[model samples]
Structures are given as C-alpha cells and as structure tokens.
Target chain A: MRLLIEIEVRFGEFVLSVNESLTLDGVTALFGPSGSGKTTLLRCIAGLEPRAEGRIEADDQAWLDSKAGVSLPAHHRMAGMVFQQALLFPHLSVRKNLLYGWRRRGQRPGPDFSEVLDALRLAPLLEQRENELSGGEMQRVALGRVLLSAPRMLLLDEPLAAQDERRKAEILPYLKRTIREFQLPVVYVSHAVDEVMPMASRVLHMDSGRLQSSAAARVSGGTAFGAILLGATLQRQLDSRLAVFCVGNAEVIAFLDSDTPNAREVLLAVEPRDLVIATGKTDAPLNAGAMDCTVRSIGEDETSGNLVLELAAGSSSFRLEHSFARHSDTVLRVGQKIRVLLTQPARVASPIVQSGTGRDSA
Target chain B: MIRAVEVIELDSLWLTLRLASLSTAILMVLATPLAYWLATTKAGIKPIVEAVTALPLILPPTVLGFYLLILFSPSSAFGSLWVQVTGQTLSFSFTGILLASVVHSFPFAVQPMQTAFENNGRRPAEVAQSLGASPFDAFITVTVPMARRGFLTAAVLGFAHSVGEFGVILLVGGNIPGRTRVISIDIYTHVETLDYASAHFLSMLTLCFAMLVLSLVFIVNRRYPIRT
Candidate 1:
C-alpha cells in the first residue's frame, strides 16, 4: 500500500535519478513517454535493476537500502513483473508455464492454480503451447503465470504495447478486473493517458525520470473508452444532445457519445486541437458547447503560426490553440476573461473521477 | 600383421570410449555450474578466468603433455600426494592419461557451454526470480533448460576430443598396453613401429566416429535453433 522509493541508477551516460515516495495501493499509473525511465523505475522497485542505489520500503518491509548494504535479490523481493514483450517460456505449454510459478511458490500467499485458471479464464488454453497462443492470449497467460506465484506487488511495463488496438482493448478490462478482484497494488507504466484514465486510482506524471504526483483518477465503474471526458455531475438529461452538468460550480453543456448514465458524473479524453478559444465573444450560446473562461497565458506556435492559449474555467483548466494569422482581431494577454468553445461534440464517459487529477489545475 | 592390428584396435577402441565417456561425464557435472558462473558473473577476474579456460585450445599438445608429465611424476608435490592416497604411481597409469585428456579437452567442453549460457541472457533468470524462485532454483529450472543445446555441443565435443587425444596421454601414460593406450596413441605407436595398415585402420575408425558425432550436433542445432 505504502512505498518509499529513492534511487539513483546510471546506465552509461543516461543517469536515472529518482527520489520520490508513492502510495501504490490501488492501480497507480506511472504515466510518461518513451525513454522517460518508467520501465527503469519499475525494475528498480522490483529489485531487478541492481545498478540503482538507494532505499526502498514497501508495507513496512525494507526491499532495498544501498547505504546499509541491504539489497534483496529480485526473487526474494516477492514482486511480479510483466514485460512489454510476452516473455512466456516457449518450451512449455500454458498450463506448465503457469505451474512453473505455482510449484515454486508451493502454498504461498498467491492464488492457487484453480483460482488463477478460473480468474484468467485460462481453461481452454491450458494445453496450448506459448507459440500457439495469440498475442493477447499469450499476455494473459504471462499475467496469470506471474500471479500464480504469490507476489507482494505487480509491475506491468507497458504490457499492451506489443498488442494491436483490438488486443489492447480486449486485455485492458481484464487487467482492471484482476487488480480489483485480487486487490493488488500495481505500478503500471504507460505513455497513453486514455489507457490509465479508468483503472488508476492515483496518477504519477513522470518526465525524464522525475516523478510528480497528480490528481486522483478514481474510476468508479471501469470506463476509459471516452474520447473527450471531464469530471461533471449529471444535473439532468434534457434530450440526447443538450445535457447540462456542473464542473466545479460552472454549468456546462456537452454532446454525449452514448445515453446519459444513471450515475451522476462521467468523464472522457479530448484532443487539444479539438478545443477552440475565441478571444472576443460573438453571441455564441451557452448550449453550443461554449463555456466562459479566464485566459491564463497565450503563446505562439512556431511550427504552424497558430496561437496557443491556456485557459481556466472554475477549478478546471485546458489548453486551446487558435490561428492568430486569420483572426488577429485583438491582442491577448494574461488573466483575460474569455469564452472557450469545443467545436466538436465530445462523448461523455460513464466512470468519472472527482475533481480530476492534474486536469490542468495549474 | 592383420590379426595383430585387429587385436590392438579392439582394445584401444574400448579404452578410448571409456576414457572419453568418463571424462565427459565428470566434466559435465563440474562444468555446468562453472560455465554458468563464467557466463553470468560480472567479477573483475572474469577475463582472467576466461583466458585460463581457453589456454588448452591454443597451447601446444606437447607443451601441455610435458607439464602434466612433470606434475604427475612422484618428484612433484601433486604426484606424491596422489601416490600416497591411491597407493599407485601417478605417471604411466590409466588415471594419468584420463587426467591429461581432461585438461587437454577442457576448452572444447567449457567454451560452447559457456557461450550458450551467455547467449541465454539474464532476462529469463530474472523473470524466474521475480516469480518467487530463488536464484539457484531459477538457474536450474530456467537457465539450464534454455541452454540445453550448448550442453549437448559441449558433451559431444569433449567426448570426441578426448577420444582423439594423443600427445598429452602419451607423455603422461607412457603407452601402456590395455591400460593407458587410447585409440589415438595406438595409431601413433603402430605408425612408429612402421605398421602402416594398422595405423590407417585405427585412424579411419576415429575419423568416422568424430564426423558422426559432429553431424549429430549440427542436426540437433538445425532442428532446435535455441538462439532466440
């Protein structure tokens, strides 16, 4: 539940310096880009990367402390790691692969064979060889194989990267189900924001190996397929198109992708380019997906001659980019009151996070 | 002359098989872990250990045989100790030739096994460990299975090299009939005595045996191709 990780590892010239403590009880997402050392952080936590020097404590247990010369090996650390590539033992059948850990653990704290077989729905694929399984099936078997060995923590390093979109969509729900059903703390590494929006209770934004804690992602009903989502309570549904909701005391209208949920609030992800900001208002109605906002900062786009505006609307903030070359009506400044608009209709997601973590709170 | 050559061939063939098989079996037991260590260890002395293991590959057979002859003689400390323990002279014995053959063929056995273990990579073992297996358990279960081809190559190479050995065994074993004179030495002795037919016969047998073993190795490698 509680983890304190402080480590400095050098891989040739690329030094990964991480000094942060985390509470990873329920699906904590390590959100970062490639080469940001997200995988390295996971490896260091699992005690697989020995080049890192520092102290790590999980649930009152000391997993690593370099100054004290106490470094537990990966096996003794009791953590299950899933790599990006499905690293199933190709020599063994799926059943044997699962049992490799079961036999090693032998009545340990982890789930038994029958339980794992049932939970992962691996009954049909037991006799199949690793090579025979599809990419998604192989990854599921790998996950089950790791889970069979009683582990104190779960570290998934972009487990869906190798899979196609359909495979990724297929496995993601199962992953969320596993974490919830088993109640295991997970440190998930991913570069995609939409991927972790529904499952991760807490989000840690990482860049260049530096970790910064973000808002609570607290997914209530396991939904992340939304293209554009915001934390809003369902004030009520007027028709299908016109629905009003409260985003931190600001009444806003949005176009929903599906039927309005019985639950109160819903969330989804939207692209930055999809959002448009108008410097001067021209009688655009509030029901047309336009909300009043204070302009925080405006910067020029050197690449495309477009102007980017950072706007804030009652506890929520989102960036909007516009072409100043075409609409150079007035000069924009910091802290200017303006109206922001969503040109396209956004699908409101079912599961919502309260207050939204790092939804441009800055 | 034909009858004499057949008799020598039968005796020398059996002796060669016994020596090669015994040395290879013992080396397998000893070298599995050693080669694993050599493959995985990040120690500062790894280069030195590697160089020592490879010495037999390039060292002159006569040079190695001369050193073994001195080391096994009763005048030397090792030879005296061996004599005291076994109640037999270390030099001019079957045990002496066995010892020399093992040293001469050490590189052939260890190199392939070591390379295989190295090529297997540390990821598999690390994966095993993360699955709650101890390091030793991971090595035996995961690493060994992955490196089986290397082991196969090592065993066949060691057996064949020991079977074809000549100079080292001769120097240490002194050409004792029915005891230390393996097939290669038998061929050498026959040629020395100008017994051309006997030499040719034994040489042909050994050549065919080596070629068969090597062919088997190639077939196994081609079939499995455990590189990935």
Candidate 2:
C-alpha cells in the first residue's frame, strides 16, 4: 500500500505536522519517543483524528482531503488500527470479539475467519471472556480481531508495549507469522529499538512532533543513538548468560542479562556510545569479538560535541561515537580502516524478518 | 358491593402499571440519544442541555406539572395541534398523565444512562468503528451491551418513579376513575374519604413494590458492576 499524507493536527499547545509518502509492504516502523506524535500520525491515517486537516491518500483512495471537504469517517476507511491498550470488547466472549469485525467486514475479500483463529492461536480461548485472558493473549486477540476486519492495511500502535519481555517474546513469533501469512502492509508504531529492528523493514524517526529523518539516513531509537542490524540470526548460547548472532558475514556476541529467547533468528542493535574504535588492527581483549571496519563517514554531534563516525563492516553499516577529548591520538577520516572493539554487548531481539531477507544486510 | 370496591381498586392498580410501563418505555427511547449526546458532546450547549434534562430532578413535580399543563392547554400551539389531531384535551386523560409521568421521570431515566455512556468511554466505540462497524452499529453492538447494567437500573428507577408519582398526576390528570386514577390517586382518594383501610393496603403494596425495584437495582449493580 502506498500512503501519501500531509496533515497537521493541533492538540492544545502540541501541534503534530507530518508530510511524507510511505510505500508500506511489510512492517514499516514509526519509531519515536513518548509524546512524539507517532500515534497521532497513525490516528490520522486511520481517519480517527478529527482535528487533522490535510490530504491523506492510501492506495489511490483519498481517505481525507480537507480542501475538497472529503473526509471519510473512520469506519469507512479500510485501515484497521490496534491501540496501545488491548481494547478487546469486555462484554464479548473471545470468539465473539474475534468475529465482531468479521461479521461486519462487508464484501472485502481477505483471510478466512478460522484461519485467523488458528494463526493467532485463539481457537482454545474462543469461549473465554476478555477478563480471563492474559495481557499478551488479549493483545493477540485484539490483533486477530482487526485482521478479521479485512482491512486494506494494518496500523499497530505499540501492540506489544504493554507486555513484559517474556510475554513479548512469546507473542512476537505469532505476530510475525500472522503478518507474513496475510502479507498486508503494516505501519507499526513503537519506541523500543529491539522491537523495531526485528519487525520494521524501514524505520522513520520522529522527535518533538516532527519527522527527523529516514532510517537509512539515521536511526535514533528514542533517547538512544543506535543502528539496527536487521536479519541477524542467533547462532547459539555460548553459556546461559552469553549468546552469539550472525549479522551479514560478521558474528555478533551479545550478553544476555535475561533468559535467552527460544527463537533461533534474532536482530541486533548497537549503540554508538557502547562501541570502542581503535586504529590498530590487532584483536583487542574483550568478552565479545571485534571486527574490521572501514570508516564510511565522519561527523560531529552538535549537542554533545562527540565525533560521530559511520563505519561499514561486511555488508552492514554501524555508527560509533568517539569523543575528541578522550580519543585525540587516533585521527579518523572518511575512508580510514579501523577495528571497533565490542566492550558492550549488542542488544538482541527475536527476528521478525523472514530468512531470505536477512542476507540483505546493507 | 364488595365486588364493586374490589373492581375499582383493580382498575386503579392496572392503570398505574400501564402508565408506568408506557412512561418508562417512552423515556428510555427518548432519553437514550439525549443521554448519549450529553455524555459525548463537547459543544458549548452541553451544559445547558444537561441542566434542562436534570430540571425534573431538583424542581418539585408541581412546578413541572404547571408548565406542562399550560403547554397542553388549547390556547397553546402544541395543545391546539393535539386538539386538532385527536379532538380531545390533554388534561385529565391517561395519555396526558403518561406524558406527565415521562417528563417527571426524565432524570431518573437519563442520569444512569449518561453515567453508563460516560464510563464506557469512546475507546471501545472507536475500536469497533476502526473494525468497520458504523457509529450506530458500534453503539448498539459494543456500547449498549457493555453498559447494560446502567440501562437496567435506569429502567427500574424510571418505572418505580413513575408509579409513585402523585403530585404531577394530580395536577395534570385529575381524579377520573378507570382513566387518570392511578394507584397513587386511588390511595389519595381513600385518605380524603377517611377510608384508612384501603389507603393502608395500597400504600403497603407500593412500598413493597418500590423496595423490590430498588433491590433489583442493587443486585444488578453488585452482580456485574459497571467497569471503569
């Protein structure tokens, strides 16, 4: 689905203005911090924001055109949105809630009712009430309910943010599998880096109610400056607390403070501040191994006054921060070769990307 | 002779039940949309509308009856329209008392429903709409089902309040046996005639009935409390 949006919404003192054209196929992450207007943008696309005034077109359908006074109500639009909270109808049984949308899906052709039930593993909980289900189960049912709505596209507002790591881990696989099965374009909104890296094919950053940049240009995960390593597969657990992953051709070993996830494939995120770049080619003594990298670009961070160096290793690109006052001896240039020591572990997440797409690391 | 007295009592009791039932039904139908609007609207006139709806709660039933009596009089446009259509006055008639009862019980019917709609909030309805249900469809399928307890309470309270109405009925619907003479009017007649026996019997019945209605409300609330 191709979405063209140019909208402005004012909520008291906060103004959310967005103008972007996004072609969503798989999962496209709207990554930002809290109160950064990511959810507002999703609401605009869903036709839920009444104060939004501008043009929004999805797949050649004008969902909203303020100039022409053509604004479709939320129900008329084919975009299904899952709120941050799992807003399953409390009075409805699990089966009824799942079928609530399906019965009203109009003539849209999409997945079968039972197919969604089986995919989201909601068959056993059909007769159960909403209060009886766990948080993760509620979220899954919520997603399945929207899926049955036969929407042209899906808009998820941090669907997994309410759950803990363990529940998130348990539900991530089901979410990815179901999305892949349906092949519907999704605009997933989230603030967590690990959550976005695994699921998002492309990331759009937002801060202070404005779009910062595209993910290819720069990916700042909320408050942390980091780079997402997509399609990274977990090799194995070296021990209970340490695990290894393969990103492109490089092996990334991560320190697991929590229990290791059951999924074999995982994505890795590296914080630039956590990396230690050295001019020498010798293997530095660190718990995790280091790899050879060539500096792709060098820039200075305006606020923090730290030298931000962009490096490329194998087919993957990484950003590492080097303080000029601390590392004055090592002069860095755009084409200079360097070895980045992994003093800190790369953040690992369960993979949402399919196996074939993992090798397109660059 | 005893049969005649029993026949009169039964007619009054039956008339009271019919009046209460009709008033409660009409009130539900009329007040639901009003209450929903009061609960959801952000317009500047919301406060004014709310105050008008709640007037029946604070003002004495005599005051409202006086205004309604004038409104239903032949001198007024609505009253004349009713006369031209039905060829009968709205005073001292069952239909007149029914309309008066509905007006008196408006707050009893609308307050609970408005509170229910407020507690239910807009999220569920929004979710239903996002899933392709129209606004009205969402309200019926989602909002109404979730707030069923409030509707139950409102219905019971409205019915009980209408049944116990004496001041409004006496003002607008004068003593006319087998027509405007409800149970409350019957009890009032017995007292005025110094017939304590009939008055005590009918009064006790209404007391028991009122208690039953209130108990039903409390039980429903306890059984399935409204979700925050």
> What TM-score goes with each of the models?
0.75, 0.79
lDDT of 1 by residue, A218-301 (tens): 221111111233456667666867676666555556555554455555554443444555655565554455667777767665
Backbone-clash count (model 2): 0
**Model 1 lDDT, residue A263, Cα:** 51
Give each model's clash number: 7, 0
Q: Per-residue lDDT for B1-228 in model 2, tens only? A: 778888999999999999999999999999899989998998999999999989999988899989888988889999899999999989888989999999999999999999999988989999999999888999999999887887997899899899999999988988899999999999999999998989998889889988887887788678775544
> What is the lDDT, from 0 to 100, of the residue A70 in candidate 2?
94
Q: What is the lDDT of residue A202 in candidate 1?
A: 55
Please compute the TM-score of chain B alone for each predicted structure, in the order given. Answer: 0.93, 0.95
Top lDDT hit: 2
Q: Please give the fraction of native interface contacts (Cα pairs under 8 Å between A and B) kept by each candidate.
A: 0.67, 0.85
- lDDT for position A207 in model 1: 51
